[model samples]
Target chain A: MRIGCGAGFSADRLDPAVDLARDGALDALVFECVGERTLAFGHRDRRADPQAGYNTLLQTRLRAVWPLTAASGCRIVTNMGAANPMAAGRAAIAVARECGLRGQSVAVVLGDDVTSLIDADTPLPLSGCNVGDVGRDMIGANAYIGADAILPALETDAGLVIGGRLADPSMFLALLRHRFGWDAADWPLLGAGTLTGHLMECGAQITGGYFADPGHKDVPDLAFVGYPIAEVRADGTVTITKLPQAGGMVTTATVKEQLLYEVHDPARYLTPDVSADFSGVQLTDHGGDRVGLRGASGTTRPETLKVTVAFDGGLLAEAEVSYAGRGAADRARLAAEIASTRLQRVHGVTEDLRTDLIGVRSLHAHADHGLPVAETDVRLRVAGRFESRERAEAVLWEVESLLCSGPAGGGGFRGRITPSIVTHDAFLPRGDVPTRIEVLTA
Target chain B: MSQTQTLPLRAIAHARAGDKGNTSNISLWVNDPAHFAAVREQVTADAVKRHFGAQVQGTVTRHEVPHLHGLNFVLTAALDGGVNGSLNLDGHGKSWSFILLDMQVKVETGTL
Candidate 1:
């Protein structure tokens, strides 16, 4: 069976995915979205509008690809439900009607949410930070669910499966297990499948989307980069390839790069389903765009599941202005100094205050600090995080007011203040977080 | 045909970077499998730590993938506080591979 990746994350480009669904014949199309911050923002959105917690791009993505998925009879699976899968499922059915699909089944997988299970008394695993620290600022909490939680939805023959907070790879792994009827005890097979899911979970990462470097590793037509497709056999052996006529090229270089993407210990890559070992894996170019994977094994799943607790982290403000032409570097530094001095005078010396001269020393600020640079143009930026929005706005206020007051040639001033949601990742025993699935037919 | 020369690691390898919380993982792939021994000898964890200097806050662990002709360097405390809390514009450090690939190495002429 073949499974195609549509959208990797919540805000993935939708058009190319349509190309994957329409052109690539597939049994399922999975969209792995709903990250930690996305769910936190989703919680805020839900509080603002009780019915608006799902992915904001869900409708646009579904509307674009549902027609093709319906025509191909390819099932849809996604974690775009974020904080609200039921609402997202209903919205998918609504889009199905708009796409002229009849008698389709949409399912919502439940029981991933553990917000109520976690309290101030709960101990946060993996870090010294305690759950009590989140206190009243806690916005949402979710456990990473797995393939077992998603299998029941597939049993109902649901055309669309919407889930919330499942592990990114689980969406693709569930489709593989259900299609191949792999046993839960099939450690090696499950390991191989998990590896496939991990490689495909990020969508275009394995398909030459992220592997391009101009002169050295050139990829053709990256503007229309294609999504990946995995051909999984019953034995769990898989060959990954993209659309034959797609814009990108799939090589061993691209495959190996993604093989270790987001992976910590190559021998013990943990997901909810199984502990996958990819240290001994090999990638073979089978001619054409297909790259074959071998030597993946799995052990028993982790006893504890990771839980991400999202909290209201107050406000983050940033402001920037560009300085160009003669003595631009000096002028940019002067602008930064003025903004920094003014901000300190008004807001006091805070550890959160960050000043950077883009194009001179931004990313590696400490290493590049005090290093002289001669640039024709540079952007001076000031950013900070504050406990209160009132204080956060001071950062932008100091930089924006610099156009006429500070530097001789600062232009294109821009500033913004937004509420920030920081996450504290912890873990609870798998038994403490039970997962189940609920199906809803259209 | 094996004259000694100094060149950037990018001449013989390419790399990609990914972040997990505060720790950053960079996998360097050798363009030619024959140069795997050279990469293994030169690109030690201590060398990587020194190269990063103050940018890396914790220890560096190297995992060798001989089958793929690759070396995975997991650098701890490299991303400040990662995406959730880092103030840097490139919080995820997605382009850090370029920085890593820029590290120079001594190699035989025409080996790359």
Candidate 2:
């Protein structure tokens, strides 16, 4: 049984695999919803645009593909609802139960809220060593729940499931592997599938974007991006590939680049299961467009769990303006100073008015950061708290007006700093606890 | 004459085979000189010459570091650029995997 998982996002862009590969051959699919703009990455001083978080473009596209998936007969799951997975699940279950899928179970995995589970006196996980204390103020702590937890839901024969962040990719993987009864110790095979899941989890990693050959000349009309495909075997070996006729090159090099993409430790590539030593991975070109991946041995699984949460961090503000034309660099530097001084004089305080000549390193570093501001994007993001939401909402209105008043006409307002509770937390489920798995269908 | 190394399917599928030029890096143990001779004979220089093709410069040289308890070889460059090599990833070429396989040839314990 082929299992797959990927993050939720706008479908029209690149990374067509999750949307494209909804056929019957795929046993199950899990879509993870994370709010992001077109080019989500390191703090962009100027983001082109950002869509509303609650409004569901990611889900709309995800749901749009459902008819195709149902036609092909693939079970699905997701956490695209953000703060509303329960509501989203209810809506989806309504859709599933519509056509004789009532008993067709779809688990709604919650329990991400663990803010009060531990205690104020309880040691946080990342604290001092000698105390043996994990004392952490998890103002925001969600369950670092793993797919093993979702097995019960899938076992219930649920056709649809919704959940919070469970390491995202493992959503599709756990359900499919468990459905197929794939062995956990089957490291090589499991690793192959897991690797494929990892590549597809982010949608565009395996596509021509991150993994494309740098020196290769002719590209397969990148205007049309193709999604990746994994030929997962019963034995656990999965050969990842794209459409046979896709435009991008799916060589070992592209795969290698993706494998190396943002990995912290090559040897200790941690996950829910055992830790696989990525340092020892090998890629072979076994003819055709296929690149065979082999030998991904891992160590014992971890004792604790990891999680992500958001909470109220109060108000944070930022502002920047490009210093373009001649002496643009000096002009930007002066503008930032002026803005800082103006704010300080007005409110008896200086908000963080960061200035940049784009491509330049950073102001903290004395040297010319990187870009030589013939024209640079100047951005400022400031956050703060409000006695009331109305007061907080007023800041954006003020900044938009400041766009015209700032010394640099280029200085403009961008995105909103919505009042959000920045949550943060992680858990360490004891290894000995049989990791209870119960599947019930109604 | 390319030597054929009996490896678990994954070794090749993932391109884990060490590629020092053209010679392959392998994970095997030899308790005696005869075994080395056997390995040397079985995985001959001619094999290296045959696999990489003519673009490479010369005979492959084997390097066995006692520290590693493994064997690594460097072969000539065969398919240098164009269709394959040019793709740059993070400013590095995805052209080859010579060093990658060199590291995977781990001689497990209990085997002399």
Candidate 3:
């Protein structure tokens, strides 16, 4: 099953590709541990830093990918963007048994930690209350699998692979369905290898940001943007390389905007297993750096079962203060609506407690769910809860100690607002969702 | 609690001819292409061909895989009326399970 995929992008820097699983030269690594590259929620001062400090994004991605996947030998599937993947897969098998590596084989793919099984109380078909009061608030909750269930746990010898909240193309389709044992009625070659793991799961947008195609070449200097692979060919056809003399520029508009990211329709392309058709995804020109995606079609696999629940729904806070010159972004949205009407007259919110401004809808993408704000700064995200978590952590620790003496300036409240809550647990759908097929390897 | 009591598959999801006609570009569950990539990343195919591309007027086709309905849409006609939105077949909401997560999986269990 020869599977491999790597990355450690931050948390105290040191991603020499997690030393390819400590020298075996590759097998597993996908540690984001938190998430980054979005800033500009008015540059800085959403009460001092709304996010960007989950301890430098997941402690430098689990101290450089759980000690190179517990000291290497390859076999990884990471969602590193954690919301607790079983305590991040038991801190990645306690750093592969504290890097002892002796008898390795980790497995923690808890079907994307369903934020406490849908709720208002728990009777949900389509949000009708009773998922025991739902709010599993998510700006992110990674958990993706489907390289045919991680190449048979990396061809039986498993090493280090812990996942919760997958879908970075299920870590590149569990390394091409564990090195091509590929089946499940081969829906258009597993929907063209699940759109080639959704076109190399976002690495340099298929190698040239925003699908760079204005006559192509020139942008190769993208300060070192590479990372997109796919040789695939159990007959589903693929070849989108990057690395070897890498840099940037895999063109065809970077595999059509990385197969149009959160994609909607370019011909059915869904993954987990076929429903991919990017209208016969055709990108021809395969010479120098290769780029071929002839005819892709997919569909098949529906027995209903896709749950992600996170519970405990309570205790949340918010704050922010920043507004640079010239009406500094509308006076920082009138000081975040005067500190949410002064925390709605001191913690009184109820329309079913939901707040926004998570880095401006995660960087310009939430207008309907709110956050169309424009200015120098705005992190007025306010949350309230009461069925008690100690009265929602004492009104979210007094909404983070009223960011520098409550609302609008205490000099635009700078640094110190860390208050992330998590004790939430939920993962519904415990039956009948198995198309049933087997094989393994990361 | 919902052990073995929800199975009535009906599917529809169209959006071809370069898209955008007022609306109509469905997909809720046409036998799983990853659940149509999670329902076209949540009801999109350009918002289902612009919201239902005038009930798929010209009629677009392609969907023949062994229907197992978690859902799949194009309502324009109401039940299966063709141009979209109509539901004629049978079954209307409430019964599906799609949670195919493969996080950091590389299982071989032995022979490495």
Candidate 4:
């Protein structure tokens, strides 16, 4: 069976998956969207509009990939559901109908929401603070579930599976398990399957999306980069490659880079399905864009399910002004110090206030190969977080004041203040977060 | 006759960096299998820590994937409180691998 990745994230390019569906001969196309913070933002959007919680690009992605998938019989699985899978399922049907695919079966995987399961006063594992502390300030609580939550949907002949906070790998793994009838208890096979999913979860990352480095690791024609396809067998071996006419190159280096992406422990990479072990994993070049994966092992699944609690972290505001010509570095630094001092004294905002000269030193806080004696241009930026938008705006206000009150020849000023989502990650026992799946046809 | 040359880690290896919370993991892979030994030896956790200097506050743990010819360095407290909490524009520290790959290393001159 073959599975192809469409969009790695909600904001990823939508055109590549269309190419995958058109030329790659895929049995399924999985789009893994919805990051932890993204769900929080989705929750906030849902509160304002009843039908507005799904990924912003859901319609565009569905329109672009669904018609092709519908024609070719390639099933769709995605976590674009964000805070509301049911609504997203409806949205998927709407997109299908709009795209002239009227008979698409969309499934909504349920039971990931566990807000009611947790006591309001229960302290989150990461923050050690109760949800009640945030009260209405809390945006959303989503439990990270795995493939089992998605399996029933795939089994129901649903052409599309929409999930909220489903573990990214689970979407692809469910397709493999459902197709091959791989028993959930088969730990090694599950591990290999999960490894395959991990390698492809980031879409083109494994296929040279993020691997290109000029002369060091050159990827050809990245503008039209090809999405990855994994050919899987019943016993759990996978040959990962892309379309023959695609742009990117698949090599051992690309596979190795992606294998360790976001991985904390190689021996104990935990997902809801299995504890995937990549320590002993092997990658061999099969030549011609095919890389074979083996040696990945798995133990039992984790006892608990991880949950990310996103709360209103108030607002973060940033303001910047640039300076150039001759004494630019010194002017920018002076402007930053003065702006920060004035903001603290006048606006009484100091704790979270941070000032940095962009061209002089911002990325590396420690690595100052000694301050530039004479920079042609520099941007001085001041940012701060506050409990209220008014207070946050005060920092920006003070920085803007520097336009007239301080600095020499500083121009190109910009300021922004926006609501911030602070995430607190926690885990609950599996028994408490029982997952259920349901199918909806368009 | 073979000789040694000091060059950036990128000369012999390439790396990719990923972050979780405040910890950053950088996987460095050698261009050739023969140089895996040199990467395993010279690219010590201490050396990585020093290379990053004060950027990495917590400890560095190295994992060796010999079959794949790769070295994974887990750097703690490196992301400045990470995505949700960092003030840096690159809160995810996605490009940190390039910095690590730029670390100077002494390798056999003929390896390149």
Candidate 5:
């Protein structure tokens, strides 16, 4: 069986997905879109507008790929439903109808949202705080559902399978499991399938998009990098490759980098499906952008399903001003000091305020040990978090004041205030969250 | 002792960083198997923690992937509260890999 990745993230390119659906001879196209913060924002979007919770590009993506998938009989599986799968399913149906595929069916997998199961007394493992003490408006909670939730939808043989918080790897694993008719207790096969899903989940990462370094690791024609495709056998061995005409090269290096991406313990990668062990995984480079992989194993699945609990985290205010020429770094440093003093003394907004000189030492300032070097250009940035808009705007107010009140050569001032959300990890019993599938036809 | 020289990890290895909540994981892979031992010897969890200093809070653990000649360093509380709450421009610490790659390691003069 062959599976292709259409998107690695919510905003991944559409043209590559279009390329895959049309020419890749794919049996299934998976779009894994939801991230921790994306889901939190999804809840906020849904609260504002009932139909706005799904991926903002759902219609555009579906329209571009639906026609091709319809023609090729390649099923589309995705978590583009985000905070609202039912609504996203309806949106997909609309896209199908618009694309002239009137009989296309979309299966929506529900029950990942477990907000009703949580309460004020619920504990958050990472924050060491209970829901009541978080001191912010609770948005919602979503359990990371696995293959079981998605399997039924795929079994329906719907043209589209959609869900919210579907575990990234499980989407691909479900397809492989269904195709191979593998038993749920087959740990080794599940492990291999999960490995395939993880490798393909990031799309172009394994295909050389993020693996490029001009002098060191050169990737050809990265501008038009291709997404990845996985060929899985019944025994769970797989080979990862991409379209021939597409850009980017897939070698052992790219494969190894992606294998451990976002992975903590190589021996214990805990997904809802199984605790996949990638430590012993072997990679063979078969010239022409094809890399063969095997030896991934797994133990039992985690008893509890991980959930992301989100809260309205007030506002994040950021303001910046640039300085250049002979004393650029000095001027930017002075601007930062001035902004810091004003935010603290005048505005009383010192809690989370931070200042940095971009060109000199912004990102690594916390750990910088190198000697200071002269810089011709520098931008001073001041950022803070506030509970109220008034306080948040104070951050911008102080930085903008530096133009006239202090510093020389301060120009190109820009400021923004964004509503933010904070998330923490929680776990729910697998039995507590039962999934149901609903099929809709255009 | 035989003649030895120092080179930045980037000269012999490549890395990619990823984040989960406030923790950041950087996987460093040596271009050649010959350099893997030199890298694994110097790039320990404690050395990495010191290399990062105050930038990372909490403990750092190094997981060895000998078969791939790679070392996975997991730094907890490394992202300054991670993507959601970090005020740093690179909240996800995606560039942290470069920071790790910038570390200088000792190698035999002719190892390259």
Candidate 6:
């Protein structure tokens, strides 16, 4: 069986997916689009507008690839449904109709949303507090559903299968399981399939998109890096490669980097389908942008499903001003001090405010180990989180005031305010969240 | 003893960092197998914890993949509240891999 990755994340490039559908001759194209925060925002979108919870790019992506996949008989499996699979299903059908594609069906996998099941008393493991203790407005919760939830959808043999919070790798694993007729209890085979899924789920990551570093680890034609494709046998051994005409190389380095991407433990990588073990996985370089992998095994699936509970985290306000020419570092530092003092002393706001010198030290400054070097250019950024919009606006006002009131030669002031969402992990008994599948024809 | 020189880990390895909630995991792969032993010996959990300093709030655990000449460091409470809550622009800590790679290690002469 052959499979290709259409998307790695919710905001992935569309042209690459279109290229895969046109030339890949793939049996299935998996688009793993949902992330923890995207799902939370999806919930927020749904609350505001019922039809807006799905991927904002769902229609555009479908319009681009659905016709090509329909012509080639390559099925699509995706979590583009985000927080609302039913709405996403209808949207897909609409795209199919617009494309003049007939006899195409879409299967919607449901039951990942468990917002109604949770309450104020529900315990959150990561925050170490009850839901009520979060002291914020609750958005919603979604369990990370796996292959079992998606398997039935695949059984319908629909051209497209849509779901919400479907585990990233499960979309690929479900297609492989359906094609190979692999048993759910078969740990080793499931592990091998899961390994294949994990490798391909990130799309271009395994194909050298994120692996490029100039003068060190160089990737060819990185500007047009292609998504990944996998060829699997019944025994679960697989070779990962990309389209020949496309850019990016498939080597052991790229594969190894992706093998442990976001994976905490190689001995026991947990998923709802199985506890996959990538510890003993081996890679074989097949030359010409092809790498082979084998020996991934698993034990059992987790007893409980992991759910991401999202909350309205109020507003994040940010403001920045630039300082250049000689003594820029010192000027930026003084500006940061002024902004900090004014926000705290004058404004009487008491939220944790962060001051960053963009050019001199920002990301690593929190460690407090690096010394500031003399630089001609520096940008001072003041940021803070506030429960009220009025207080959040103070952060921007104080930083903007630095132009004339605090620092000399400061210019290029920019400010922004955005709604923020906080997510926490909670587990629910697998039995409580049963899945249902519905198929709609286009 | 054979001649050796201290060099940055980036000279011999490449790394990528990922995050889960408050935890951050960085996978470091040595470019040459000959330098894996030296990297494994020097890049211990405690060494990593000290290297990161206040950036990491919780314990650091390193998982070794000897067959692949790789080490996975899982740092807990490292993101300062992760993506949604953190004020840092790079809240995902995507650049943390370079921070790990910046650590210096002693390597055998002419191993590059």
Interface DockQ per candidate: 0.59, 0.02, 0.01, 0.64, 0.80, 0.73
The numbered model that scores best in lDDT is: 5
Q: A1-442 in candidate 1: lDDT tens per residue?
A: 8899998888888877998889888999999887777999998999898888899999998888888887888998999999988788888888888788778878898887788887787776545757896554788889999999999898887788898997988888888889888898787888989998999999999988878989999998898889999998877778999998787888999999998887877898999999999998878899789999888889988888988888887777889999998888899899888888877787774646788888787887655323357687799888887787776778888888888898788899998887777787888887888767766555
Please report how far candidate 1 places residue B1 from its true position, in Å. 12
Ranking by DockQ: 5, 6, 4, 1, 2, 3
Q: What iRMS does model 5 reach?
A: 1.0
Runs in model 1 lying further than 4 Å from the true structure: A134-136, A349-351, A366-374
Q: Is candidate 1 or candidate 2 better by DockQ?
A: 1
Give Cα distance to truth, residue A123, candidate 5, Å.
1.5
- Each prediction's total of clashing residue pairs, residues at least 3 apart in sequence or on different chains, is 0, 74, 117, 0, 0, 0
RMSD of 2: 14.0
Q: For candidate 3, give the docking quality class from DockQ.
A: incorrect
Candidate 6, residues A20-118, lDDT tens digits: the string is 999998999999999988998999899899988999999999999988888888999999999988999999999988999877999999999999999
Tell me, per candidate, how large a share of the native contacts it keeps: 0.51, 0.00, 0.00, 0.60, 0.72, 0.65
In candidate 4, what are the lDDT values of residues A1-442, reduced to their tens digit?
A: 9999998987988778889978878899999897877888898999999898889888888888888888898999999998888898888888877878877789899888876666677677665567776554667788989988898888787788898999998888899889999899898889989998999999989888888889878998888889999998887888999998888989888898999998877888999999999999878899999999888989999898988877787777889999989889888889888877777787777567777878777777666333334477788888877886777878777778888888779788899987877777778988888888777677
Give the higher-TM-score candidate: 2 or 4: 4
- Which portions of model 6 show Cα errors greater than 4 Å? A366-374
**lDDT, candidates in the order shown:** 0.85, 0.45, 0.42, 0.85, 0.92, 0.91
CAPRI accuracy category, model 6:
medium
Top-scoring candidate (DockQ): 5
Instruction: List ranges where model 5 is wrong by over 4 Å.
Output: A369-372
Off by over 4 Å in 3: A1-3, A6-194, A197-263, A266-294, A297-442, B1-112
Weakest 10 consecutive residues, lDDT, candidate 5 chain A? A365-374
Candidate 4: residue A409 lDDT (0-100): 91
What TM-score number comes out for model 2? 0.63
Worst 10 residues of 1 chain A by lDDT: A365-374
lDDT of 5 by residue, A329-351 (tens): 88888888888887788877757
- lDDT per residue for candidate 1 within B12-111, as digits (tens), equals 8999999887789999999998788888999999988877778899999999888789999999889877777777788787878877887778887667
Backbone clash pairs for candidate 6 read none
